[model samples]
Target: MTAFEATRAWAEAQDAADPLRAFRDEFHIPAHAGADTLYFCGNSLGLQPKGVRAAIEAELSDWAELAVEAHFRGRLPWMHYHEYVRDAMAEVVGARPHEVVAMNSLGANLHLMMVSFYRPTAERSAILMEAGAFPTDRYALESQVRFHGFDPSRDLIELQPDGPGGTLSMTAIERAIAEHGHRVALILLPGVQYRTGQVFDLEAIVRLGHAQGCVVGFDLAHAVGNLPLALHDAGPDFAVWCTYKYLNAGPGAVAGAFVHERHARADLPRFAGWWGHDKSTRFQMGPHFSPTPGADGWQLSNPPILALAPLRASLNVFTRSGMARLVEKSRRLTAYLDWLIRTRLDDTLDIVTPDDPTQRGAQLSIRVRAGRDAGRSLFEHLERHGVIGDWREPDVIRLSPVPLYNRYADCFGAVEAIEAWVR
Candidate 1:
């Protein structure tokens, strides 16, 4: 890796040589003071892709011309709208086409996956998850435990970080599963930790949990487009993710789910709905429910064509850029940001995200050393100076340099703004 220099010239040089630099022009950067804001908030909501409007408008045109017939007749036909994005989405997440599907929201998909994979016997009913997981995950686990006639306090195991610098280690994770393996029915974790920006080893987690007779799953909301994943080979029972973050999909876009190919014919219990019925006989109105064999079998209703159009557009961008290339750039881009902070704002800020690039994505969760009030002030200061980053509750401010659209110059400019606030 090249050593980073804390200068705008160095930043511009990196951006000048960046092969992915042209991709930045594809997004609509938010404005501040008559110029584009330094957007480091793709970890929250991604900037709108310039192609999204046309994507949405295409569907609208079909609707106007074809109406109800548009389901089977259109540029991209609504009947199999989810399928339109499946191959590209699978490519992004590293899964087979049949193994991935664009469907319900993240929370809803989590619940549906839990229904099939969280079947608990009296002897093996506990769920092991990381401590301080996102609130939505925590709530879902709690409710699932209660619904199954178990006490969450006793059945839910929150794994803590025992590695150096308060990060979870493979040793710690292995030890936790070993100790709780006998009583654990399921293990759910994030591909990337939301608050700290720690990327877990998905393959290792699957190996550990499966070795212990546990059904493992992942919430990849933070990992999906930010990192290249191999969910198929990693062999998780299931994985769920939202497309709006690093995917550059619009707000509240339809989410996705992945089910391993091994479960294609398994007689697992699932929440049945009409949309999941066998396509060949779906309109026959058969009284019996026969699921569509793969991840698509998990659908509860027909996909929202309009919501999926933007996702289609965004996935096309990802397809064109390729995850491997994007990730390579992400490492360098984030490392530049890290370099700037260490050199310029070390006295006032601390990076909660790991220094090791492999252990994180594009996001760097920064902690203000001057305390919460000072942190809030610093965040607002950055906002005033045309820098856009998100402040998590308490003290951390998340700055993510998305490879698809963010440049090295954005990282440098953002750090400069933070330095000004400190001065």
Candidate 2:
């Protein structure tokens, strides 16, 4: 173990000095058995913000009172509902307002982006992705290749990581693109890996793919609000992310997409819908489809006002706290958690997440090595003791202490629980 001392007094002192500590009260932490659970699973599903209840209720009230007129007359009119989330979402992802849009769920948005960006020719007809990607991304990419009348096993190029549960090196990715870029029509990778919590070099990957003539995209489900992104500057063809995790929206919340301004023109072949049509001409019910400029042109239907309201509430919190401050606190919290695990629980566990703050997000994937049951037993032990980290399939316990709500004391209590259980 290292020389770091994570004592209770030290934890309390750190919590006292933390500028973001007051924001913790804005969330509703769940109770396990009777007491409040430590709740360290924000990477999976975030705790609900206190404002979410009123936001949902407001939409419900408006719907009840106005009926169809709610589209135009409600406090937040449904006709232009998605517009409210645009600037906030753009700020979160570091995109231009015209380049980002709140739209369908993550997977759906990925498929929709692929529809416009995954065009393949006989000479360039393959897709390159990380080996062992999130199952949904693998499935979507595979189905996309099949739809293009190509064989997944033959046409999908995969770059292997440095080692099992390790980071994918930029050199390996560049080498893969150099070898297969001619045949690769698209390059799709995650900004932050879901299982290992590795943050990829998004700007480098985009540059390499473009130099090799491949349309690049990112599935930022783990990266969006967790990391400060510059999607417009990095300039991927498109990117997609869900709002439920770091964004603190409820389950199945509305997802978002970024389409580079380069593709905002009418010439792009997209599946058009009435909602994506020009708003002024849309009410006229024209015979032909004329898309709204930029990312909004990708919309398929009107948004769910109730579902979007929670995001509006949550984004307000983000706007107030600011991403830069949140990231600074996130790095400190994860570093403390890492230090505690190394110094206190060294014999029983190993952290799979990257040590460098630049190479990962808030999640720490701890691999259990001892005890009655390898992973699940320890996970259950933590839960029974009022700690609420989640267990991944084979042997990983994922704990994400969100900067907005988690405290140094929470980290201390979590490590103390492990120490008690292990002893």
Q: List TM-scores for all candidates, in order.
A: 0.98, 0.97
Measured by lDDT, the strongest candidate is 1
Q: Give candidate 2's TM-score.
A: 0.97
Residue 135 lDDT (model 1): 91
Output the lDDT of residue 90, model 1: 96
Mark the regions of model 1 whose C-alpha exceeds 4 Å error after superposition: 164-166
- lDDT by residue (tens digit), candidate 2, 270-370: 88888999877888998899999999999999888888999999999999999999999898888999999998899988898889899888999998877
Number of clashing pairs per prediction, in order:
0, 0
In candidate 1, which residue pairs get closer than 3 Å at backbone N, Cα or C atoms, i.e. clash? none
lDDT score of residue 1 within candidate 1: 63
lDDT of each candidate versus the true structure:
0.92, 0.90
